[model samples]
Target chain A: MGEVIVITSGKGGVGKTTSTANIGTGMAMMGKKVALIDTDIGLRNLDVVMGLENRIVYNLVDVVENNCRIKQALIKDKRYPNLYLLPSAQTKDKTAVTPEQMKKLTSELRNEFDYILLDCPAGIEQGFKNAIAGADRALVVTTPEVSAVRDADRIIGLLEANDINKTHLIVNRLRADMVKEGNMMSSDDVVEILAIDLIGIVPDDEHIVISANNGEPLAGSDCQAGQAYMNISKRILGENVPYLDLEVTKTFFQRFASIFKR
Target chain B: MGFLSNWFKSSESSSDIAKSRLKLAITSDRAVCSPELMEQMKNDIIKVISKYVDIDTKGLDIKVTRTELDDESGTVNAVLASIPIKDKRPFRG
Candidate 1:
């Protein structure tokens, strides 16, 4: 009985795909059989993020439409042998997949993989419903901005209404300097407003963009965002890992000194 | 003198303002009522009460908020309306 977690945010461009790619890769690096599903359908990008777009011969629509076997549609990651991506169909719309089909797909995947992560599209529409239909838990991603937090709150309410009660928050793209200057909401502030358990916070790092451009997830790397993703993965595996200390990025000496403490 | 004055100024941070605004917006959102709807409801209540007694519309305040339950089980969406009564209307009958 594997766990199926949905990565969702009601607003676009909040790093849902990036989190899904990194966390799935992070879990695979830890020796778990993980499958990442891009439920975005027409706006598919998870394959590109995972750098497996060139290897995709079949997609989610093909699998659901009985055009190919599930094994044929699964793409092996370039770096991790255990991580696989089920790419979405770029030509098909969100209406192509129903919640029942998603539930059945996840149930079948659950028998083989340790974790199945669904990268949901941005909205409270049919795609969101389909992604969460088979999920056992949810990780709501949001930035520290007002609009992102507002949409996060909306997503939380919808998740609860659908009875997916095991939900956690990941506040991404936090600027430590802005937070220190009282110009942006801290993670604590975000958690207080959303009234949910926080899983992790990824600092705003340029390395994240670089890794995304290269189609390589930063989870196993030594960058701050990479470390953050790795920590989030450990937490997902039921480890009692502490949150990443954002202030560690302030000084070179401190970053070097803290490595010894680890 | 500059530091002292700065300390006494008591200006709110931008994040603080954002927090308060989000709180207010979410409270109304969970209540399933927009700001316009809340205003309309307030006016209707004022009109109905005004026929029976003189009410101070200027002093009226209505807010949508969350209230903690008595048993501490969880909080619930609540509407808190404060209507000031000025005087009773004379009976025509």
Candidate 2:
């Protein structure tokens, strides 16, 4: 059976959808049959992020409601043969499906795929609960801002209370320059506060937005953030991979260029 | 000589300079205990103790501490607190 993983965050706009797409694509690139499930029912964006919006004829709700089969709803990625997406329904609310339905859907998909990545909706509401109900593990995504970290902490507490302890942290939209100037929180500070094992640190790369807009994930390229996502995918597969020094390389070059200009 | 003597006087309370006020605030916030309540409790303790013995109520100290719990057992591992009490005065036994 494939491993079911849920990518979630308590606060909105923390790049949960983006991480789901990139990591799913990353796993597919590594020759794993990966299925990315969008659980953000009403306000779905994973389809657009994955550039599969135009191909989504039948959605998750359709599959659950018996309007279509699971294979009919799954949109195969054009670039990666192993990657597939089960888009969420944009017209229906989250109540259209129950947690038991989600569990059944993932369990069925688990047999045919190597990894099942669920892109969870924001907030600790019904949508969030439904997203995580069928997962074997979870990835809590958060930004470095104080408010986001605080909300992420509350979500972590909730997850632990629910007995979902195989949780990992992904710090997204990190700005190294801001951290160096002490204007933003560093990865170390976030880890210290959240007290969870770090899985990935994706820099605030505008390329990620552009890639999502173009339906291409940065993980397919050699971009720093893309490389971070790839490394995280390996780590998820139980590989002892070291985290890349995303800030050091850029800062060192910047300092060297400044000295030369002087 | 005057400048050196002034430096010594200012440096006498180095503890006051090194201690952070925000750290104290965080400790209080984490424990959900207020400084005002702590002060009142200290006063009440001093009053009760003086009634039992001729103790120097001005020389007592009370503080609250926090501790972290064990990770595997999900138990609190550390305790952090602040306690306030009457200052201890060196005097008769």
Best by lDDT: 1
DockQ per candidate:
0.32, 0.08
Report the C-alpha displacement of residue A128, candidate 1, in angstroms: 1.1
Off by over 4 Å in 2: A248-262, B1-68, B75-93
- In model 2 chain A, the worst 10-residue window by lDDT is A253-262
Q: Give me the TM-scores for chain A across all models, comma-separated.
A: 0.94, 0.94
Return the TM-score for each candidate structure.
0.84, 0.77
Indicate which candidate wins on TM-score: 1
- Judge the docking of candidate 2 as incorrect, acceptable, medium or high: incorrect
Chain A, candidate 2, TM-score of: 0.94
Residue B31 miss distance in model 2 (angstroms): 8.2
lDDT of candidate 2 over B1-93, digit per residue (tens)? 544565566442322321233234434434434678877877786677666455555555565533445576552323332333333542435
- Residues A1-262, candidate 2: write the lDDT tens digits: 8999999989999999999999998888899999999999999899888888889899999999999999999999989999999999999988998999999999999999999999999998999888888988889999987567767876776777667879999999888766764557778777876778899998998789789779888785878889989988989988888977766455777877745542
Error of 1 at A214 (Å): 1.3
**Model 1 pairs whose backbones collide:** none
